[model samples]
Target: MDMKFKRNFCIVAHIDHGKSTLSDRLIQKSNIIDERKMKNQILDNMDIERERGITIKSQAVTIPYHAKDGNDYELNFVDTPGHVDFSYEVSRAIASCEGALLLIDASQGVESQTVSNMYMALEQDLTIVPVINKIDLPSADIPAVREQITNELGLDDSQTQLVSAKTGEGVDGLLEAVVNYFPAPQGDVDAPAQALIFDCHYDPYRGVVVHVRVKNGRIKTGGIIRMMSSGIDYKVEQIGIFKIDYEPTGCLEAGDVGYIIAGIKTVSDVRVGDTITNADNPAAEPLAGFKEVKPVVYSSIYPMDSNDYEELKSSLEKLKLNDASLVYEKDNSIALGNGFRCGFLGLLHLEIIQERLERDYDQAIIFTAPSVRYRVHLTDGSETFVDNPAEYPQGRIQSAEEPYIKASIITPATYLGSLMELCKMKRGEQTNMTYLDEKRVELTYEMPLAEVLFDFYDKLKSFSRGYASFDYEVIGYRPTQLVKVDILLNSKPVDALSFLSFKDNATDRARKVCERLKDEISRQQFKVAIQGAIGGQIIARETVSAVRKDVLAKCYGGDITRKRKLLEKQKEGKKRMKMFGDVELPQSAFLAVLKDNEAD
Candidate 1:
């Protein structure tokens, strides 16, 4: 029996492109996982992913198959992050496998990101196994899709496979393709053990649960290991290999992937792309191609109450245990009091965490507008983080810079003109374009990451009528005119509403932001003034609707009905009002300015 070698693969698709449903069907048909309990994106492993139907992180599982040749084979599969913010982790996932299962919705066909992901797979020298998923849908066009994969992704007829990840159709053929087409690992078992830690998460008791791909080595429970990159050494407390059901695999050798539970317990202890090796004779260097993710979005997260400061800190620490990409530091927020300024890969990733904190932790969070990190050039010749516009010495700042990204999109040909208008509006510099098929086109542009984060997807959906998908990767940072936009409430600065913006858009952006705040904030028991000011000049102003019925006019001698209403009103007043001199400022006044909409 020639050792049957099957290529490990992962399904990569854009959000709403049906990656999870397809994976669910694949696992279900193998009888490796029960469908009744099978939730969408079971591999997501996070409550957030289940609710959103998006895979924010990558996951791995194994399903055995009986090949057409009547041979036994194991298909080790991984599911990866589709969003660019998680690209750092996604790159590692791509490296762990020999091929990818690129799922495309039959009706939507090839999306903007589908081509990008396929190209990344090619860069890794991984074989492309294109999948036309959701074929069972009423809208699915099977023939046109096969052409797009071959033309856009450069896949041959042999590489294209269509399947409905929903109905479990064509999945067996997809399994067969993986075994027949993809090449197995070419390695010597006797060579030095060198595995790569593609990704890891903090697992309280176990510390860091390092996800490793054995490039070369043998590992087992109780074996001592060292993170060759971090110089951190620990004895393997447990070795668990992934199946539909995880169990003690006893050991993992060269070309296999599994989790290593070492005594080392910290996120900082295991980094993506780091090499793991035997402790006694460690590999001297980490693998090349490890790129540290640069956070492009910044915002302040504060608790509604000043007393919740400690609670917020503990909450962030917990979030950081799993998300090492997040960076934060203690800071002051005038509106919400003490808080921390946090860095995120992008805005979507930032909003997701804030929502998770509120939903999962049941804590109300006061969030500031997202701002991209700015590079400032001082007259004295120095570079500094101009995060807080308040800290910026306007006259002294000679020049400023912000990060930029290379964005690409795939959509129906009908959306080409509409999306092009949007791209131009976002300062998107046209790079190139390719037609995926007669009905679909792939558009490429270079855009400022800041502009992309400020509701690029929302705009894309509206213009394209929800037919297009968006993706972007940071190309590099460049010098640009950046300014800080500040908000004032009754002439007093509200720190949480302040953010960074392009100088050209400042006045108009300020006006729009002020308008949004005015709309979201219901009028308090007192009139509140909202102003958008640049230095001494006020560009826009809006006032909260007056509280006409707040004054007690019909009460005499504390009449029973009036007295009851008065008592309840008094409690409510105390809950929301803060007094300074003769005037009372409603807590609602502070909250009214924290609107979700970004100003134009």
Candidate 2:
């Protein structure tokens, strides 16, 4: 393929703004897949993505389009995730492309994430094509969305493409516009081979399937390739492009996006942002790959069965190959046994990983309560960071700080007051408020990441009646009154159930955990005491009463002294049982503490 006729771009949009749908339409129009075999969200191969109606990973495809200018063009585009949690994926997609289709819902207009994604594309200096999607909807306001594109996004309205991805209306024109509007990918085909690894997945039989965007030179079948970061060499077994399914091309030249199979067995040998270059004629410097992804939320994952620890480890390694943002290290808990302390971009990211492990990897896992990293200053004038409750410093005497984020939320003007109140309740400080238009408003707040780690997003949606959109960026840490709240069952602290909470809400949080545990734990032969405590002070307590055995039932006609003696013996036996008996904490009990009490 000629480099001048090749166009590499990606679709960037907010969640539910029709990126995947638009990709499906392009694929259908390109005639890549047979009509009978085509499906909705064809680019999203993961079952979780289909079930959740969201794209978790970025997918690339090659579209062969014959433009109106009497020229054949090869359009390669990546369909990226819109959720704030997967912004890293979007960044990688943007890096691999020279242009971006910024899709906006016609009815929703400009949203928080929409603006965020546009800025991301702008940062990469990509040619952005503003796209107003869902124009076929009865509620679609094309003119209003056009105004947003001009005023809010500072994009020319005349350049915006209005289309309905669902109805496939004006899609042909959109494809033509992509060819004419976006510039051709620029790279030296004769230079040393340097392909940026945007993604990869493990195939049991073929080994690691590395997704690459060739920047310079060409990669041929059965050629030696080396990972710039790891300095490991492998033989490229095959090269192919994605047309929903892998289509072998034998060779991939510069300015192309495709996959490479090198029979690489180790998961860690290939990294998502590493550069792949020809070993025989290597590039002097690796391509500027990608920024390191930092995880804002942390949790401990343990196998339900202790023996599945190795399985869990292998699953995580394989999962990490696909999800580079997920970071984990060996972690263990006294109550939960062996586990891994994993870091995620957000709560949704955490949930997705948990689900993928269970569904794709067939590993049953337990996740502890999610937490944000906290900076602790000890009395000895030393500093340390804590993400896991068990690792919280016991002798902290000086001060502590928690990570904070600048949150941007867009919603209808009518819900501004309620959303503001919600943020206030979360200990958020109003940073800025702007009226995007007469009907919609954008609110910015500075709040602790720990506050949003739980049900903040859920509450925001509920408070706005699902009209709100949110995006956030970490804004460093602020001094806070932090306390480690521990949940104790029968006077024994469960390390997995411990969590850090703000001092003001620690009592309420502790009380909720105790109440939740009370409902989850079954009645035992002896009284089970569930207590939430900080240091020596007990903040909240719940007691699960013992299941009584009626000793007096057998003495209905007995004398009062005999009945009294039987009752006294029963009381004595109960005391002994309380002293020796153990309170078994069910899996549900651990999950119960993880749930937000107020979210109900």
Top lDDT hit:
2
lDDT of 2 by residue, 1-600 (tens): 799999999999999999999999999999988999999999899999999999999999998999998899999999999999999999999999999999999988889999999999999899999999999999999989998899999997888998999999989989988998999998899999999999998898998899999999999999999999888999988899998889999999999999999899999898888899999999999999889999998889999899999999999999999999999999998888999999999888988998899999999888888888999999999999988888788765599999999999999999999999999999999989999889999899999988887789998999999999999999898999999998889889998988888999899888888988889999999889999999988999999999999988887695799999988998899999999998888987776667554253
- The numbered model that scores best in TM-score is 2
Q: How would you encode candidate 1's per-residue C-alpha lDDT over 158-264 as one tens digit per residue?
A: 67787877778888898888899877864445666788877676666667777888876577788888877668788988887786556678677777777888877
C-alpha local distance difference test of each model: 0.75, 0.91
Instruction: Kindly give the stretch of ten consecutive residues in candidate 1 with the minimal lDDT sum.
Output: 578-587
What TM-score against the true fold does each predicted structure earn?
0.86, 0.98
Q: After superposition, how far is residue 17 of candidate 1 from its true place, in Å?
A: 2.5
Candidate 2 Cα deviation (angstroms), residue 258: 0.7
The RMSD (Cα, Å) of candidate 1 is 6.0
The runs of at least 3 residues in candidate 2 whose Cα sits more than 4 Å from the true structure, single-residue gaps closed, are 556-562, 595-600
